[model samples]
Target: MVKKFFIFFTFIFVSSLLVSKDITLKAEKEKEYTYKDKFMWLWEKIHDPKSGYLSVEGIPYHSVEKLIIEAHDYGHHSTSEAMSFLIWLEALYAYFTNDWKPFEKSWEVMEKYFIPDKKTEQPNMKYYNFDKPATYVPEYDDPYKYPAGVIYAEPVGKDPLSDVTARYGYEMYLMHWLIDVDDWYGFSKYAG
Candidate 1:
């Protein structure tokens, strides 16, 4: 009777340990799923391919038509705000879907327009109206007078290194992480 009780107690102890470990692992898996679900929900909500951008803040416009029109009209061609946001969105979408095609498409468009000339090292922020050549349009149509590399905060686009550059730096850091991925965008070490 004593031997049987001892064996039964030992079995119960071992079984409880195994059960607790399984429960912990299950909880961890559930947590991961919950995180993925939240991201997927945001992707569904803010991803607007028709507008060629993500809303970022998840502000809902009246309609998809309105979103597209707003993006087309107000989207900056040169600012890090415009380019980095798009890159971030594309990267997230690709990460979620395991599809690189969308990111690749956006990359081609961004490479052609958003990235400023390395020689000038300035963001010209030229708007490439899809199928048209990237062109800089100053308020007065005087591209030659506009400062080349610095981010201007003033109305005339002349002020350099504005407060918005902080946002740009952050976006660049995110892009560095997103694009540094292997076998996706072709691993390139981003020095900046």
Candidate 2:
């Protein structure tokens, strides 16, 4: 009788475990399915094909580090932090959607103009060499001289490190699971 009771309890426990596992997996799949639909909408709304960067209202504010879209022609310059968010967002979007084209395009633009020309410069500082040229220009007929800084004249100013540091931290923290551990940078000592 005791043996039968033990077998019955074991069977019940195993069955409950299987059922709960199925439910959990189904919930996750449902969540992803919903997000996939919304991702397409977000892509259409935020993507700026002309500049290869997300914009406030279909307008490119390349001059400033940041820009705020206003109701009228009134707005403020966006911070470098905004661009950093966009980079991380783009990577996250690609990871979820399995689409690398947009991420690749955006990264190319950022790498050219924003990824710092020297170690002394801010990580995400916007300054490309005027003499040379970037590989991708959304639309430009001139020699493509925007603005940049050397070791001293960094555009983002005294506190230029925050945005870049945040970006690197996120990339290093998450990309290991999404991509490859080898593809990501090591944990930043300066993140503190």
Candidate 3:
């Protein structure tokens, strides 16, 4: 009886340990599944060409360029520039990845609607008038002629004008910064 009891107790303990191990394995699998789902959700939202503009969630590419142009006319400088930059960046990514559908769409919009008839000439002075509001312009001493410091010269009070180059340049810098940061953080583990 004593021997039997010992064997029985050992079996029970071993079985319990096996059950716990299985439970842990199942939990880990579930966790992995959940993480994968979250990743997919984030990836779809960020990279989906059809819905990927900075504002106007889920806007089609055909309309994105028109929207940016209108935004530029309306003096929504930041929004217009950001949308254009994002579209271009997305196009570049799609091209490299051999996903030409989004790239084509973005390019069509850029070509049809967003491309300026002419690039704005750089201001001779480091500073240019931001608007009616009197603000001192910052110096652009760099050889590349990239505008340094704030883009806007002054508050502009109630009135504003869309400085196309300034807006686009600012947006490009910001988008590059964000992509670099994302790469650094290992969020974009795979380079597309």
Best by TM-score: 2
In the range 118-142, model 3's lDDT, one tens digit per residue, is: 3342233224444553544566667
Mind giving the per-residue lDDT tens digits that candidate 1 earns over 2-116? 9999999999999999999999999988887765688777666556545633332322222333212533332211234545565677798788789887678667655644443
Q: Sort all candidates by TM-score, best to worst.
A: 2, 1, 3
Model 1, position 42: C-alpha lDDT score: 67
Candidate 2, which segments miss by more than 4 Å at Cα?
Answer: 1-33, 48-78, 119-192
Backbone clashes for every candidate come to 3, 5, 0
Instruction: Identify the runs in model 1 with alpha carbons over 4 angstroms from their true place.
Output: 1-33, 49-78, 116-192
Worst 10 residues of 1 by lDDT: 173-182
What's model 2's overall lDDT?
A: 0.47
Rank by lDDT, descending?
1, 2, 3
Query: Regarding TM-score, does 1 or 2 come out ahead?
Result: 2
Instruction: Supply candidate 3's per-residue lDDT for 148.
Output: 51
Q: Candidate 1 vs candidate 3: which has greater lDDT?
A: 1
